[model samples]
Target: MDNNIFGYDHNNTWVHQLTGTSKLLFFILVSIIAMISYDVRFITLVLILSLIILYQSQIKWSQVRLIVKLILIFACLNLITVYIFSPGHGAYLYGTQHIILHLGYFTLTKEQLFYELNLALKYLVTVPISLVFLITTNPSEFSSSLNHIGVSYRLSYAVSLALRYIPDVQRDYQEISMAQQARGYELSKKGKFMTRIKGVSQILIPLILSSLDKIQVISQAMELRRFGKNKKRTWYMARKFSRNDYLTIVLAILIVLLGVWFMKIDGGRFFNPFK
Candidate 1:
C-alpha cells in the first residue's frame, strides 16, 4: 500500500522485526537523554549511534530526502536566530569570552560557535531517530503496543487512525492536484510562487470535503462494528518481544546512563573544552 507516506512497510529487516513496544520504548528513552544533555561529547556519540541505526533501517533516502532538507533549513534558521538574539550566549554559558569575530551587537566567540554546533548536532541526532520511529513502526502494532503499556485502548486506536490517515490525505492531495492539472490548472513550479500557492490552496477545499466524507464513513463503520464499546480488545497484530528487542532496549538504557555519567563528570550539561 502507501507505505512510504504513512511510514510503515513490511520488510525482512531486523529493525522492522523488533516488537513495536520495544522500539517505542527505546525511542522515548533515547530522545529524553538527547534532549536533556548538552555535553558535546555525549551528543556527538548519540548522533553517531543514531546515524548507524538509521543506516541499518534501510529506509530509502528518497522517502525522507524532502523532510531532511526541511529539517536542515529549520536547524540553520534556529542557530541563526539564537545567535542573532544572543550573540554571547555561549560565552555566558561557559563563562569564557574568546572572540572569533566582533560585529556591532554580535560577537562570534569560539564558545558560542561550539554551543551552536552542539545544538545542531542535537537536531541531527534526534530528527532522524524520530523519523525512524515514524517510518518503521506499524500503526496497528504500535497501537497494540501502547495498550500493552497500559495506555487506554481508545487513545491508542486514535493514534493508529491518525497515523493511517496521513497517507490517505497525501494520496487525496495528489489525486486532486492531477485532476486539476488535467483541467488546465497550473499548480507546479512553472508558475510564479504566489500563483502556485494559490493553485494549491484551491485543492484544499475539495480535499477537506473528501476528508470529512471519509471521516463519516469510517465513524459509521466503527459504530456498526461496536468499536470502543468494550473496555479492552484483542489485537491481531500484537507481537511478543524477542531477544533482539530486549537487547535493543537495554542498549538504549545504557546509552542514556552514559549520557548521565557524562553530565556528572562534566559537572553540568555543557561540556566546556575551553576550560
Candidate 2:
C-alpha cells in the first residue's frame, strides 16, 4: 500500500497544506469552467490554471505519465469525433475561415479543425486538474472535508473506503495473478490471441474470491467496532481552515463565478467555438 497510486505524501507544500475543502472547491470550479466553454481562448485559460495547479502540487510528471497519456488519447479521440461530426457543417459559424486541407473522401474545414482544437484544449484543462485532485488530496482528507460540509460521518467514511478499495483491488488482482502463475496456470500466453484471452479468465475467479474475503473481513471489523452506533465521529486527519485556505476558497469561488459569467455569454451552455 505504500506505493499505491492513490496514496498521498503528507508534506508541507502550498498545495498539499491547503485545506481539502479548498482543493475540492478549486477542482469543482475548474471542472465547471471546462464544461461551460468550448472557445479556444477560454479553454486555454482554464488549462493554464490547471497547469499552474499541477506545478504547485509538485508531483513528478513521470509519476503521472500513464494517466496523462490516457487523457491525451481520450482527447485525441474527442478531437477526431468533433471534427467529423461538429454541428452546422463547419461553415465558420463565428469566425472567417477557409478550407485547410482536402482528402479524397473527406474535406477538412476550418471550423472543424478549430472545434477539434477546442475539444482538445478542454481535455487539457480538465484532466490535469482532475489528476491533481486525485493525487494530492488524500481520501481521509476528502472524507473529513465532506463531513465538515455537513455530510454524514457514515456516508463520508463509506466514500473514503470506496476510494481506498481501488488500490486494494488492483493489488489483490496482481497478487492473485501471481499465485495462479505459480500454480502453473498460464496468464501470459505465447501464441494465439484467443489462448491469451482464455488464460486471463483464470484470474477472475481468484480475484473475486479474494475481494469477497476482504469485504467479509472489513464487515466483521466494522461490526466489532460497532461502526454505526455513533452518529458523529472524529477524524484523525481533519483539516483546519487557515488564511491560506480562505484565500484558496475565495479564488475557487471567483473561478466558479467567472464560469457562470462565461456561461451566460454562452447562452447557458457550452460556448461553441464554431458558432
Candidate 3:
C-alpha cells in the first residue's frame, strides 16, 4: 500500500494496531462531543483530548499541514462571519455606556463585540476537533472499521477507494498539465488571472476523461473478482481491537460524560451574548 497523506500507516504502534471499527467508533464519539454543544470549557476539553490523540497517532505534524491550513482558513472564515452577522446588542452585555462610533451614521455597539468574541471561541472549540480527526484518522482504517461494525464491505471499500484516489488524482492532474504545456499551452505562472482560469478550464476536460477511464478500469477489475458476491469479505487492513483500544474508548466516553454534565449545568452554547 502506497502511503499518502490519508492512507494508513502499517508500522506497528498503538494507533496503527487498533481495529478499524474501534477507531471509527472513537472518531464518531469525539465528533459528537465536539458538535453537541458550544460550551467553552467542554469544547476546550474535547479539543485537548483530540490533540492528545493526534500526538499519539505518530504521523508527523508536517504530514498534516494541508488539514491544518484548511482548519485555519475555516476558523478565520467563521470568525469573520460571526463578526459581520452578530446581532446588534452592544450596550446590554458589554456594559459599555452608549458611546457609539458612527460608521457613516450606522453605529456599532459593545454587545456585538461580545457576541463576536463568543462566536470566535465556539470556532476555536469546534475547528480543532475536526482537524484532529481529519489528520489523525487513516481513511482506509476508517473504512475497514466501518465494515467491521456491520456496514457492507462494498460500501466500506468504496470509501477506501475514494481516499486512495486523492493522491492519484493529484498526480494525474500534474501529468496532464505538463502534457498540455508541452503542446503549446501557456498555463505557467506568467499567465494573467483570466488566462490561467481559461487554461485550467482546458485541463478539466482531459482530467474528467482520464478519471472516467480509470473508473471503468476499476469497475472491470472488480467485476472480474466477483466483488459483493459474499455477505462478508476478509479485509487486508482490518483487525480486532486490543487492550489499548478499550482504554482509549473508555477515556473518551468519560470525557463525553463530563461534557454532557457541564452542558446540563452551565447552559449549552456560548455563541450568543444573551446566553
Candidate 4:
C-alpha cells in the first residue's frame, strides 16, 4: 500500500490496530459534536484531544504536511471571508460589542475575533481526525466494517473502491505527466500560468480515458464474481471489536456528553467570555 495515497500511512500504529468500525464511529460522533456546538471551551478541548490522538497515531508530519498546509489555507480564507462579509456577526451572536480596532465602515471587534477563533478551532479539531482515519484505515477493512455497522454492502463496497482507486488515480497522473515531459512538453514552473493550465488540461483527457477503461475492467471483474448478488456477505478483512475499541468508543461518547453538558451550562452553544 502506498503511504501517500490521500495521506494514508501504511505503517503499524496503535490506532491502525483498532477496528475500522470503531474508528469510523468515533469520527462520526466527534464530527457531529464539533459541528453542532459553537462553544469555544468545548471546541478547544476537542481540538486538544484530537491532536493528542493524532500524535499517538505516530503519523509523521511529512506524510501530512501538504494536506495540513491546504487545510490551513482554507481556514484562513474562511476566516477572512466571514469577517469581511459579516464583521459584526460575533457581536450579533453574543449581544455585545467591544471594538478592538476601528476602520471606517469595518471595525474589528473582540467578539468577532473570538468567534472566528472558535470557528478555526473547529476546523483544526475535525480535519486531523478525518486525515488520521483515512491514513490509518485499510480500504477493504473499512468497507467490511461499514457493512458490519448495517450499511448496505453495495454502498460499503463502493466506498472501498473509491478509497482503493485514489492511489491509482495519483499514479496515473504522475505517469502521464512524466510521459508528456519526456516528449518535450513543458508543464513545469517555467511555463506561464495559462500555459501550464493548458498543459495540465491535456493530461485530463487521457487520464479520464484511462480511468474509464480501468472502471470498465473492474466492473467486469466484479460482475464475473457476482458481486452484490446477495443481500449479506462475509468479509475476510473484517475486524472484531476489542477491549480497546470498547474503551475508545466509551471515551468518545463521554466527550460528546460532556459537550452537551457544556452547552447546557453555558445556556447555549456560545460560551460568552465577555459576559
Which 10 consecutive positions of candidate 2 have the poorest summed lDDT? 1-10
lDDT for 45 in candidate 1 is 85
TM-scores, one per candidate: 0.94, 0.79, 0.76, 0.93
Better of 1 and 3 by TM-score: 1
Could you say which candidate leads in TM-score?
1
The TM-score of predicted model 1 comes to 0.94
For residue 167, give model 2's deviation from the true position in Å: 2.0
Q: What's the CA error at residue 183 for candidate 2, in Å?
A: 5.0
Clashing pairs in 3: 20-145, 21-145, 89-111, 90-110, 90-111
User: How well does candidate 3 score on lDDT at residue 121?
Assistant: 54
Model 2 misplacement above 4 A:
1-4, 83-97, 101-106, 180-199, 260-275
lDDT tens string, model 1, 37-63? 999888888888888888888888766
lDDT of 2: 0.74
Give one digit per residue, the lDDT tens place, for model 2 in 1-275: 34545445565678888877778877877787677676566667778888888887888765576677887888788666766565434555545456677653357767766666666677678877787777777889888888888889889888888877877777777787778778776666554687656656877787888889998999899999999897888999886789988898788777777767877787754455544
Name the regions of candidate 4 deviating beyond 4 angstroms.
Answer: 1-3
Ranking by lDDT: 4, 1, 2, 3
Q: For residue 133, what is the lDDT in candidate 4?
A: 91
The total of clashing pairs for model 4 equals 1
Misplaced by over 4 Å in model 1 are 1-6
Every model: Cα RMSD to truth? 1.7, 3.6, 4.2, 1.9
